[model samples]
Target: MRDADTPRQEPTDDRSHPAALTPQQRADLIRAAAAEVRERVQAWRDNPNWRNTPANSHRYETTLGAIGVLSELPEPQTEEALASLADAVRPIVVEWRPSRPGPEQSIYAAVERLWRTIDVHT
Candidate 1:
């Protein structure tokens, strides 16, 4: 069952849609998202308790690896150039959730905002 208030999920077919962006636009969106993620991860690492929890530490490392891959691109990519990247990376964004409610709200909120922006921009 579905509710009228629920937002419709965007179709996954990158090639068939009229709203589809050009290769350059997709690349720009990817770069922007990657930059935002990197900045957030850096702030997380700066927290004194970030390394105290093994799970948190592992998450930080995984985020670092993802950022590294994004940063290593020889040049900015095009929309077609980024389709594979988007497919490979979307799952990671989908899997993220805020672990707690207070300060964690910012991270989760940012994730949601970023997700929406990427969805539309890409």
Candidate 2:
């Protein structure tokens, strides 16, 4: 019988939960999410509507910098990696206002998906 002080355990067979994942598995998922962030950011930058002003350029650089940090993170740093990804995608998630549906929206959606993974699993 389980004691009152003992914690309940989640099923390991459910890969969707982070508690059920090995460190390597979590790192792999974080890497995939980071890759998606990179792809979406690149697409946004490539869009003709994107401006080349200094402020915009700075935002782009900062976001990419965060992604780079996440990419190089070693395994067993899942929380750190997620923090970096969140920082990387903040501009897209919070600031960018696309006039119409385009790469900006794609980038936003990608960021949201990454955060969702963190939320659901973590």
Candidate 3:
């Protein structure tokens, strides 16, 4: 029965989305997600053959989708923290060959955005 201009109400359940997160909780989520990105990038880099494979592409896509959400975390970033992440990803950039933007490029892109977001906010 409310008019369209009425401000929408947030869920009072305290379990809804970002509202459920305290600053510490949100920071922890960001840390965890960044860690996952670092780990996945290392996993791919360590096993170079997996970069452009057929069977693994699906899995990479799913992981990238998750990383995309992590990259979108709504928080101001600390550059020192983000710098290590960018450094973790630096080697990935070194290995990239320009053909098209596929799995490796997508992974690279997400981490690139992640660090850049963190840097910009800092």
Candidate 4:
């Protein structure tokens, strides 16, 4: 048995939970997420270390696509989809590092973190 102080893990059933959001709500969530993403992207762009790295640019593009998909998803399904999308993008981010010559760090990880944070609040 778990201790009382332990946090409860919410049950997740995609069918029931994901299907609960209305279309408008989903769109709103997407917009909010996109705004956050844009801010992060701008930060990345402003970073001198990130400017010259081609890998970072590619990662940024991939994140943009993911954000688009997130925006298009049905409201109810957004949570599950975002979680899955974050997972999918994590590896790409991890493989990218600024130190590597050809394949430096990508924005994937940062994006994933952003998605996860959004998922929690929404």
TM-score of each: 0.62, 0.63, 0.33, 0.41
* Candidate rank order under lDDT: 2, 1, 4, 3
Between candidates 2 and 3, the one scoring higher on lDDT is 2
Clashing pairs in 3: none
Q: Model 1, range 59-116, lDDT digits (tens) per residue?
A: 6666666656656654436555565555444544664587775434555565665565
Model 2, 1-122: lDDT tens per residue?
A: 88999877633344567546665676666567757877877877887888888966875776677667766655555555545544544444454444347776676666665665555443
**For residue 51, what is the lDDT in candidate 3?**
60
What are the Cα lDDT values of the candidates?
0.59, 0.62, 0.48, 0.50
| lDDT string, candidate 3, 5-80, tens digits | 9876533433335324454444554455456555656576566466666634654554554555445644435544
| Model 4 whole-model lDDT (C-alpha atoms) | 0.50
1 or 2, which is superior by TM-score?
Answer: 2
Model 1 residue 99 CA deviation in Å: 2.1
Worst lDDT window (10 residues) for model 4? Answer: 100-109
Greater TM-score among 2 and 3 belongs to 2
Model 1 weakest lDDT span, ten residues long: 10-19
Q: Write down the RMSD of candidate 2 (Cα, Å).
A: 10.7
The lDDT, on a scale of 0 to 1, for candidate 2 is 0.62
Quantify how close model 1 is to the true structure by its C-alpha RMSD in Å.
6.7
Looking at model 4, residue 112 earns an lDDT score of 52
Question: Candidate 1, residue 48: CA error in Å?
Answer: 2.5
- Model 2 poorest 10 in a row by lDDT: 91-100
